[model samples]
Target: MSTLSDYLNEHLPDGWQKPQLVEALSGTLDRATVYRYLAGSHPRSPAESVLEAFAKVLPGVTVVELRAAANLSAGAEEPWVPPVEANRLSHAQRRALESFIKATVGPIDDGDEPNHRQPSVDLQPAAPALTEQERAEVESYVQRLYASGRKDLADRVASSLVNNPSIEPATRPADA
Candidate 1:
């Protein structure tokens, strides 16, 4: 069985029963569909929405982990840098980094945001709680960014989390 199937089969009974989970979804999915998913009768991976809803109420599991298990996620290939921090870097620093990247990665797309990016106040709100796994991933990636001398990107990704506790998504790793 797939890891997602095994996780569902094992954990479903621990916290939520079949009928109970169907109802808990608030009709997001039909009873028969849940049963089929539970029974491992479905061929495709569960929809992101289904897994997301399950992760919402499930205690320990995370949507990121679930998506990985379902073979939906490609796994982290490169560091997931933050864009909002571009504004914080001095123009010289931005140019230096861009030159380094351009030499290494050919050319950045024309649509890429330049040094002057949108402010944090302009960012859209994200409220769902970040799972432990997601938090760990963010911390690990941020550390990698710092170690690689990309403090600007690191600061951008993590500064929002530590600098402001009130920003909903910044408080957590962001909605899984």
Candidate 2:
């Protein structure tokens, strides 16, 4: 299983940030909605309208293909299969799909295991309750206090948890 970032970074061509793509689509969808799709956390199953929009912006992918990619299974509900045959691709669409496959699929190198594992998209490991950015902001505030020679103030700020009353004392590393 790969993270959503991995799939987006590796599979998508350049210039495919969710916001950029959504704006390009113009009122069709929101970027958060797209992230929900990619993160496989959409409330309802992938909608046709959203799928169609993605098909247009993304190269080498159809609505069906995007749906498949979006609903990659990994300890989540299986992807909802399209119900109506009407929504299915036409002959031309199939031909385009074939061409896309031809371009994207090539021989695996010797000892390479193509199709050895199913592909999946997952969120990055659950981040700390406080994110790196949040921690950086806190650290920056502490640094400002230190820079102003407010050592006591900086120590208080550094030791205090913004949300929690009980704070863990900063510990030195074994190497230090």
* Runs with alpha carbons beyond 4 Å of true place in candidate 2: 1-10, 70-176
User: What stretches of model 1 exceed 4 Å from their correct place?
Assistant: 13-15, 74-176
TM-scores of all predicted structures: 0.40, 0.33
Query: lDDT tens string, model 1, 108-144?
Result: 1223222122111122222233344444445565665
> Mind giving the per-residue lDDT tens digits that candidate 2 earns over 59-109?
765554443343322222344454575266555444433442332222222
Instruction: Give the Å shift of residue 139 in candidate 2.
Output: 69
Best by TM-score: 1
What is the RMSD, in Å, between candidate 1 and the native fold over all Cα?
Answer: 18.1
For model 1, where is the 10-residue window of minimal lDDT? 114-123
Name the weakest run of 10 consecutive residues (lDDT summed) in model 2: 106-115
